[model samples]
Target: MANSVFGITDENGNFTIELPSWLHATPNLEKACAVKVIQLPLDSVCRLRHGPSSSHGIHLSSSEDGFRTYTTGWIQLQQHDTK
Candidate 1:
């Protein structure tokens, strides 16, 4: 199984996620597996809601409680990018 990496967005609403270097060096994810954005939040302190779901890999959902916009995206190996 692939190890999971986690990152929180900075004050500028930017986040950086890094995978094991071995993945690229060994090419373990070339075509056998895909890098995906987990749709579900593993752990959250505040209220959370499931927003709009993506048919492809990208997930665009909204926070109905505050009407705030929450965006999530995912990518699959050998697949076209989706917005």
Candidate 2:
């Protein structure tokens, strides 16, 4: 099981990573089943921290006529850095 990474678009059209519901069910995500979306400065580096066996991923979707549509792909989280 591996954690994944994902990106979301901000008001200014810039992209940021988030760990939404989709990521929770990932193979190794149970450890960090709860997730939060945090916003930072536009030029700052973003970081994701998780415990052992925790995973992160993202999904993109849209709703129309009471139905939801999703994109086909997801980002992958390969490793963690403890600094």
Candidate 3:
């Protein structure tokens, strides 16, 4: 998941997306399309080790098989470091 994007963005927030040779682009995504990019909070990320992760951000069970079916719980920030 990490180290996927490797391009410098200009001041206008525009950059060329060059995927590695190992990665493949889906036919539908080959052309410019409206993509939904999600950025999870630092605490919600599993590697942060904030607390006992309950189902990774407490999602609601849904019949949809896609990620849109999942949702995160209320943002709960701790006052101190976990370490």
Candidate 4:
């Protein structure tokens, strides 16, 4: 596990999280933690992004049956709505 840089949580169970300088620049927090965009292709959102494209990474995808290149897990989950 990653070493905790900050102190423990308070009585209210609130703790401060100071992200890295690179994380601060990232717009999407979810994608920020997991994705790393190398050799950036045509992105509809970050087309005008500055600095090296390798600095940012693309989203990950997997096949349900381990055959296809792209996966629709999130979309399928949304459609099924098991909740």
Q: Highest TM-score, which number?
A: 1
Q: State the local distance difference test value for candidate 3.
A: 0.38
Candidate 1 backbone collisions, by pair: none
How many clashing residue pairs are found in candidate 4?
4
Query: What are the runs in model 3 whose C-alpha is more than 4 Å off?
Result: 22-25, 30-83
lDDT on C-alpha atoms for all candidate structures = 0.40, 0.44, 0.38, 0.34
* Residue 74 alpha-carbon offset, candidate 3, angstroms: 26
What is the model-wide C-alpha lDDT for candidate 4?
Answer: 0.34
lDDT of 2 by residue, 15-76 (tens): 54455567545564334443333443455454334333443433435658844334334322
For residues 13-83, write the lDDT of model 3, one tens digit per residue: 33456545444443433232222223334554333224434323324336354322223334343454467
My TM-score estimates for the predictions, one after another, are 0.31, 0.19, 0.26, 0.29
Ten contiguous residues with the weakest lDDT in model 3: 28-37
- Taking the tens digit of each residue's C-alpha lDDT, what string does model 4 give over 4-44? 23434354433344655555455554344432223223432
Q: What is candidate 1's lDDT per residue for 1-73, written digit by digit as tens?
A: 3465656655443455565666544332333333333443344332223332322232325536633332345
Sorted by TM-score (best first), the order is 1, 4, 3, 2
Candidate 4, which segments miss by more than 4 Å at Cα? 1-7, 33-83
Better of 3 and 4 by lDDT: 3
Against the true structure, candidate 1 has what lDDT?
0.40
